[model samples]
Target: MMLVLLLLIYTSQHALAVVVEMNAGEMSVLLPCQFSGFIPDDPTVMWTRNDLVPKSVHVQHKEGDDFQGQNQRYRGRTKMRPDALDTSDFSLTLRKPEMTDSGNYTCSISGGRGERTLEDVELQIKDQQVEVKVVEGSDSVILPCKTKHDLPEDTRVEWTRSNPELMLVHIYPHKSDQRKKQDGLYRDRTAVNKDLLRTGDLSLTLKHPTERDSGGYICTIYRDKDILRQKVVLQVKGWFPPWATALLVLLVLFVVSGGLLFHFRHYFMSVYKVEVDSGVESVLLPCKTVAHLPEDVKVEWMDSDDKKVHVYQSSSDHSDEKHQVYRNRTEMKRNLLRTGDLSLTLKHPTNEDNSTYTCTVYNREGNILLKKDVLLAVRVPQVEVDSGVESVQLPLKTTLHLPEDAKIEWKDSDDDHLHVYEKRFDQLEQQDQVYKDRTKMNEDLLRTGDLSLTLKHPTDGDNRTYTCTVYSKEGNILLRKKLELKVKGRVQVQDQTGDIRNRSSSIDPTPLMADQSV
Candidate 1:
């Protein structure tokens, strides 16, 4: 027995161990390296992937570094700090790491005698985030979170919202979620199907997400004490009255309305409604150039009062013109001159941020090129939804161009398949019984990246999550979005006399006869 114990101890001494795990697409990760004994000053350090033999990830000396025959996989990724050796640090840091870079990295330091093993760290990169955009007034929304692995029963999954408010979004303790401790804002508004969780899905279904429902959500899964995290940022855009401002803007800018439209060419202007989570995180106002401009072109964002939101001039930002309300709360995307993306970002938007702003692009000669009006709408999770229409249409539109053979599937809160569009046709046989003959889709729209679904005779039972997932023929998810539909109960009616009256419940208005439909 003593001999066996001694052998086990010997094996443990040289056993390979994974010291770190990280998510993919992270900015950077440091692989720690420390010599077991005999700390050498100004020693040479080399990091290599065990799988890729005869190739070093990084090579550094006391003076400089040389990567003559480094692997192409880590050509521009691996680097070492200049003052690393001064602090007995021989760690290798990888920048802009990808999921494909997962492997066992071996670090070694060379001294007067020879090379000494420092550490063998195994790096694991999780999947990149998937985006799912939902309109604010939707009855429900689906926050998709999943893992391809069938984890152990003791696996701990935590969903929390740290921005805007540090609230416990959801917690899946052991086998099931503990909802009693949930915040009052999300007590019954959140749900996770047990059957779907068993099949490796941790997606949460939320009911009645108003403008406030937009924010950054973090889903963390802990298995065997190793933590794997996925981040999802939800942008809940609200639908304001469009026609209310359309006629007014047209009258102010058109020739027929005592305004100038000829020389200014206001028709070239663009319009967008930006969604922001209330007190959640920063919001983005997307503004990009339709045509590239000069290197020193100027970009200005201002409100109606000519108050500058952000002004880029003289090759740098002019913070002198920044308003007091927006002090130190805005940032522009890096390298905008190269990418022609002139979007503006507002940090930690709150209800006070609901307003209109104008983004203008000017050439180096101060020539107006493009002007866009962006409306910032904040969304909050509310108890009610706007039930306006009679045969509700659960909007699920995608903006990405898809191939002819893309696989699209729409599912409900029950995890049942509601609609399946694949193989260049809609598979009616696989649709759930609740959706049969009531669902419709425009196959032509799918090719153009529009995946909006039309629901007929929508009832209160349909006030649930509707997730639409677009997949490639090779089973890769191309795009996915979730929307909610709520049926109108207390109908507000308008008759021919321009008389408006509110009707209680589903009862028809007195002006409508039994033979007439809504």
Candidate 2:
């Protein structure tokens, strides 16, 4: 229940509206209220919120500030100006403000018979953070920022970069925006829609983001005395930086000058170009080293920024200080580490992960041993399947030959087996109840890696994730692929979450196949 109580206090009186803005979880607040003119001896001042009972927030009496009759909730959390005659200052102070503390506050003063209201203040808190990602040297990057509350046309919006360098990125004050106060690097490379400000849009359009342009940006909005704030962190990936390219060219020259002596050694360095569909559920960034590692070897994997993505040592994973967003979603095959395979599996990757990942292998003595650079290229799949009643064959055929003793497992969104082929036989009894008899797989073609599954009748519930896991004779995970299953057999309908969909599709009798590009 909301507490709001007002008993006909307005009698042809104009109350001045003042807005005091701040984010939630603040330590304290000062509500401004003052009156000009003469005072009668020791004046009686009272600060109150109509919604709060007893109507007493703070009182200034001749005995020097009292709160004996004030509401207990705000008894010791409020303050007001003591000198009302000479300074004519009257403002309420609140401590430990929260989201629920946002509302209307009234300051009424009564002394020597006459009573009048001083000011009506409205305090607000803005709480939201936006993220933006861009490819280095891309055409432009747009940062979306909008406040739940509306802003006046003359509201001021200022953009500033808080990381790498503290500088003014852009500004719009006195009803118009200009680059005069903006940093020289961003003067001609930025623009914002002025008309959009009328609808609470403080979005900024940054043109042509370079390598140095990646960092945190702050957007401060001001209207009259009210203030709102937003923060955006932009990540720039891709593009060969000029410095790194030059160093690479120098390395080539150094190798050529030495009569191509290290040419043969280059063959030993492993490089993997892993590519996957943009919307895949997961992807593997392959990393391996032929050099034998000591038991206490420290392994580190990092992004282009040299930020630690994963770390391992002493036959265990140490993930401390890992980036907050990528903390728990990263893992490695600990069972295969002793054999020199240091592949990192990233779960639920987005476009931001479409960058270079450097795998650094270190010896027990902290000496650099081997470095493998894995370039991850993410793009939409080439084939597009339309959802309809027609049978859709999900094309998944591999060139690798499967041995007779190979193992394969097909799973749905729930990680339950939809189909399983192991020991040269089809095990339908091991499948989940939802796909008991509806799944079909050709066991005779198992030797040709034709482990595909076809659904007898696809339905709306089939629109979900499906994965295929293959293992070698040694029980090692040979390959894994995840695909999205959709259905369009029924009419378009909206679900309880307000999402409308027409889902239906058929898989080509083949089980899930590994993502093609990688």
Candidate 3:
């Protein structure tokens, strides 16, 4: 009985000291040991990294039993999977492995059976660097799957194009570091799709593109553990076709042909007709030349006598000798090519100044255009007056004067209304009205320009104003003068003394008789 008990204890001790050989990359390798030898119920399981020693052990207590492990990098990341705990599995699961986590790990537990240790668990961690591919101009590009694993936060991504003509447009952390060439045509027209930075999408787009942009491109991912590369072929198609090119050429030809036709019509075929107002103080003679003509073209103006009246050369400074009667008054309306305001101004016009004028434009290529026979007319009007306030009484008549062609008419001051004079020239002569007998004029003095209308019996009522108006042949009222009628002296008075003495004598006869008796 003693030998059987001893043999059972030795088998349990050998089983408790079993090796926990963990082959690298296994899902969850069991640390070839169990807690059944200790307490069949709850027992502590512990693990530790040899690199971290005792200081980095993770400890867990179940009732009075304790388990511990020293793995600072894997501190809370290790746990006994709940499903495996019921089967005496004392194995720990690493949530995610990193390159820095490769080392030896051990599991130890102290309980009712005895203190047991599982040694030399070679935890070999490897980084499966994933393959990423970037297909240029494809639907999309994918980043390497290695980025999905646990990696250092400071890891960087680099994108490069394998083709010499193609280049990296932009990258994160730096915009200026993006590959660019001074002589490249797309120098400023490329940009990256920055919205997908989180998911590791590094894509770029070109603006106003051409087919030459199609080429191979590369995207390289740089991590602390490894580096990754991807290649993509970009395919491009022409935006414009052969038909579009032909249409563009035709459009340019049509524009040039139309411009030439317009130039021919303006320079060789167009005509301008000019008319000037008669009797004006001066006349403006307008002349227009083709806008395409050079600024150095010379314009000459000539009168009917073939005398050069004015000369305008754009290259020469302004001179009075080259100007017509009105110096500095003649001006082009606007810049030569803008508006043909070659309208000239004349000053102090007269009848002799009326004639046909000619405008000739000459360039270095000889006479280019001409405008002929523009007529200008000047007019004058004669002055005459048809009215009569010919004369007044002695004192008033002395202050009056008249012109040679004056006519006379008479009317009473009270009857003088504007409409009263609207009678026929002959009817005025046949009238024997109140003014007929009262007024007269000296017929012989009229030839000497003396229009004196004498009033026979002038009275105070005649003290009013009379107008003498002179008119031009054009019916223009040229001159007007007003005459005032005046009367001099006072009136005589008669006495009523005798009748007043008689009335007083009859009313007071008693006082008179008393005075007589005394």
Candidate 4:
């Protein structure tokens, strides 16, 4: 019994500490160590790493902290509470932790009799992983690596490509603007922000990305002896973009034979094109067919990644099989089979929703019935208005008649309510203070189907993405649109009108698709 009790005490000491994981660019991390019970007179607390040279990370004695023997690598980057020994809490605070700081540390106390191990801490600092994808012939692409904390002034940022072959991409704070020491391939194609250290944005911009530019790039920020790194994997697609390739193929087919052009157009119709603003409430992926489907048919919608988006069968939605990302966010009409409409409504559509979706219908016998493809493109439109204009109108024209009890709201990207229209009238009490009396809407917006908001005295501070959302009486989202307002200084009113006119003209009014003979 005595030996077993000693073994349990030893096991508890090892189990007291835990593995701590953090990113390399984090501000700080804590390695916890605590001991309770009677105090040992003249005790000396030590935190040391076995693999590091000199080993000692931090030392606290009855006389106070003894840094005379601390490792040079961890001299000024570690700290402990002033009353740590009194409170029996000997936790170590590590500042600006980097990948090189990953190691196992042991905390032990030494007294007049001997020494006893308290706990062991395992730390792992990992590099952030970011994947960027873009098509060839693009004007530019940004590899993002940002931190909330501003780096030291003496820090230097280095961007390099490691895979395939080691090469220098870009470096900040160099003497020359041309970056003469950069690799030949990225000499003129690579650049970084002018004030990256101050802004904490160490992103690298590559111009006209091609297949050769696809590789793994690392952004390393060095300050004194500490180094932080983030890795980004870039993928550049085909020689020609998908849109350009499709247009070229269509032209060739039209020139070769009219019948071939017709066939290709039919195929194209099967693939619908849908474009919406990034912050829309939801978007519909239409898949309607006139042919009567089987009573026991199964409908499934899958994204480009082959993940299930929505599924329906036996006159009910099988939401249990949906992907986690789409859970509680997808809906389909109950009478889809009877009406031959198999549209899927995805809520809170974002830029990540920009993908090709496939809708397939299978009969009870497991034979395919119909298949359709939809490509969703979520975009943010820009609206430029002169700073000194009397009022600028954020235009939104829809033909659908909104519900009488629906609520129409205009909010900025900051989530501030700019204007609110509810219960058939403007709700001034709900308007944000900054936009209290500077906003207006059409008196009969719901009836006229013109839900535009006019803002008076546009200023540079008002330059932000504005979202207009209409909600039903049941709190269900009816419609949503996002518009980026750019308040330009010293610009003529005519140019602002031209900008709005051009943006309004760019709206596509054609039907998504027409019923065809199956």
Candidate 5:
């Protein structure tokens, strides 16, 4: 039974341990240590620092304990909660952390076999804020990333380039550890505080920092497997401020104000181009006036046929055309007296919808306030043959039928200056030297837009990219296809003795002979 009880106590003790975590730059922190299987009796807990002569202390649950040692830096600053001990809370609170207060600390219990555990807390103190000013092409300026934290003796602090393209001038931890490079323009300009490494003072000094160095920089502190990082920005400036800097600033403000006025005037007066996708059910056309006009102003929307779609005069009255095609499709969104929201929306679209619409606004005095026009282009997909395909063979030629209104243009890729056939004009009988007597299209299919051209003598050199562009009253459409020519030829040689040998004798020789002769 005694052995069983001992095993239970051991398991409970192992299950209950203390944990301490300190955030960077935290001044006060609670180091909570848990003690399981507590009897609630008067327990004695003590804390100590890891130093040459460790500062130790003892505390009682009833009366508070203060453990300020001969180290004047941490005097009268450590304490623990009174109720924490009764509830098995052995947490220690450190006050006002300093550079000297960084190291491993231990929390131990003197009751029930005297158990103790050690944990380390790292304290990082940020460096003083610095302002850097440097000029372009001037001498290198040094910006330091420093801190005031006491680190381990063998800790390594480094200054690495945040941007790899920029080279490091130098890194100094000691006089003998100075690194210098000849090729880098900033070779002899960078340095750091070497003596402060053990104390976690990672201050970086940049030498000859250029305008390119006006970015982020990192200072890293490495100790064993732990790392602490800090970042700072180095700004490069041109020159210093003078007594008349305020006047110069005012002058700049005046110039900027004038420039903004000019820009707004130009933007208000300039005509804006409106583009819309085809098949759109509705579109809002924006028309806004610059300044205030008389409340009794008139606005109207006119289509290409000079037909009035909608008209608005005064704030309460609107005129509509009953017989218009777009009777319910268009309306004015706002009044011109307050907001110039002359935006209009079209309800449904049709192929006959291709036209340029005009927005005209007139003031009460019958003077034109604003006049703007927007071209509405509706688009449809049309299949057509591109320009560069000089010829098509027998099998491919049968697939040349296209839909209606498909515009086809044929031009030689080798010589674009020559036109093979234009839809508005008849086909040219004579071809250019490059395509001489080699290209022709089916005459009957030409009326229906079958623009498949056939080459008499196809060659590999005729392979080229052909662009087929189709235009409609709505808009323009484009498609591209590549044509590659593969020619098959037969050669025959007859001796004077009348002995004739046939090339490809089994095949019909007429087509091959005719193509080769061309």
Candidate 6:
């Protein structure tokens, strides 16, 4: 018994051990192993993963490489040097690794005498995390999935939700999408690119996504024996109107209309409603005042959290005193003091930038001189439609009736006027030529408050952001909305059986858990 124990210990010493780490979407990774000294003729090299059935990962002999006993997961993804045994190098190359491929692998060698352990390799594969947030009433949202490798033509793509519950969201097999087995919750709500494999962009578009649809989604691509997966988290927030603030604003307007503007001149500050897309490079916070102020006064902009956004003093900019969140991202006009236009330009504004900003002017003694408040709503609601559709509508619904003399204008990101309305009628004189006859609106939009624009014959060129602005006769912006339009090419799919084969070892999804080390 002692001799047998000694022999086992001796055999363990011959096995070289190593560990490798790689991300899930990577192209390939190498498990290294090297042996020196004599190599017998007609030798055999074998690799196996103990936990997997049909443990054979790869095998090679004097004849050539063999796959008769290999596991289905490693059928077409495992490779080694042609002259591995002759050179005593028994490394293996794994292509398109996935989260399920993390484990321990054993390598062995045999010849005329007997078999012996060669090496042991431990692999750890991790998935990259991505998060996307959208408002509850958005038309659609995209869960992006991009891969580096060129997958096979016959690859099968499967999108599944693992968080909250295990469910199948979408599937594309062979050359078309299969929806029969899709979860009822995602029925008629999911779409993918027509030529995903060719473009390497397998982004999944979810239409009319609600808060219930928010969760962790896994996009798994199956190409023959290889499985690649990536994870994305989606968050949908519900919209709630601030009723008290709206009532206060109405009271302020009532007081101003009663010729009491002079009484509230020191207390009332004009509010400007600014809406912009999150994808925009910059947004201007308008705070113009005609009141003359002391030359030694300081202008400071602050967010709802009272964090300094931008500051100007001593006849120059003082960005060092701004909050770290706005560092290097806030700018002001050079002649703000001269022009009395204390507009703050914020760069690369995101969802986190959505809040009310206060601009306060202070004298040399730190006493408030004048103040203005600007409410910035950075929203980019996406609306996707197929090019085959006859027309697409940019929806904007408000319960309150707009001013009768208000001029509503619809303009694209390129400054092209898509539609215009003034004096309760369509104003086509200033409309862009490209949208002269392609745009339409309701007859009494001022009363109905449904300023949705319908664009006929949507095409790829129509893919851009459209901004809707309502201005009163005094040239004050009353309302603004930004909507992103995506016109995708139509996809033609035929009814056929989902050509699925060589599914991953763990076909049924397991709950997203912490990473395991082997």
Q: What is the lDDT of residue 396 in candidate 2?
A: 49
Q: Model 5 scores what on Cα lDDT?
A: 0.52
Q: Where does candidate 5 clash, by residue pair?
A: 140-208, 141-208, 142-206, 145-204, 386-468, 391-453, 392-453
| All candidates: TM-score | 0.33, 0.35, 0.22, 0.37, 0.26, 0.29
Candidate 3 Cα errors over 4 Å, as ranges: 1-281, 289-291, 315-318, 323-329, 384-518
Per residue, candidate 4 scores C-alpha lDDT tens digits across 1-518 of 99999999978855555566556665677777788856688889999998878999999888888998899999899988889888999889999988899988888898878888777887778876789998876778999988664578887788888666677788887658637666655645677788887788889899867776788887776654345567788998976777888998878767566577544553446578787876566789888874445467789999999999999988789989999888767899877876778999998786657899999988655656678999888997888876667999999877767889999999998899999999999999998899989999988888898999999998878989898888889877777778899886552122533442211212223322346211
- Candidates 3 and 4 compared by lDDT, better number: 4
Pick by lDDT: which candidate is best?
Answer: 4
In model 4, which residue pairs have backbone atoms overlapping below 3 Å? none
- Please give, for residues 128-243, the per-residue lDDT of candidate 6 as tens digits: 67899987778799999887757787888889886555788898862334555676556557889988888889999998777777788888776553456677889887653467
Each prediction's whole-model lDDT (CA): 0.70, 0.69, 0.46, 0.80, 0.52, 0.79
Candidate 3 on 127-159: residue-level lDDT in tens? 443333332233333332223423345545554
Write the residue-wise lDDT of candidate 2 on 1-518 in tens digits: 12222323342122346777665544566777767766666578777777778767788876678878888877567876656545878777789876766777777777768877777877776465566777765668898777766677677888888565577888875234464456555655667786766677778888767656678787777766555666787888766566877886787767766857355444334556677764455689887653335455677888887788898887888878677656776899966544668899886565457778998877554666567888777653332344444444444456666677888888876888888888878888898898878777765766565666676566666776676767778865555555666564434445778787664434432233456321
lDDT per residue (tens digit) for residues 74-104 in model 1: 8888878787677767778889878878877
- Poorest lDDT segment (10 consecutive residues) of candidate 6: 500-509
Q: Across residues 278-387, which tens digit of lDDT does each residue of candidate 5 receive?
A: 33446666676433444566777877789886787766535455236776566666555456567667644433456777888775546565788766654432222222
Deviation in Å, model 4, residue 510 alpha carbon: 43
> What clash count does candidate 4 reach?
0
Highest TM-score against the true fold, candidate:
4
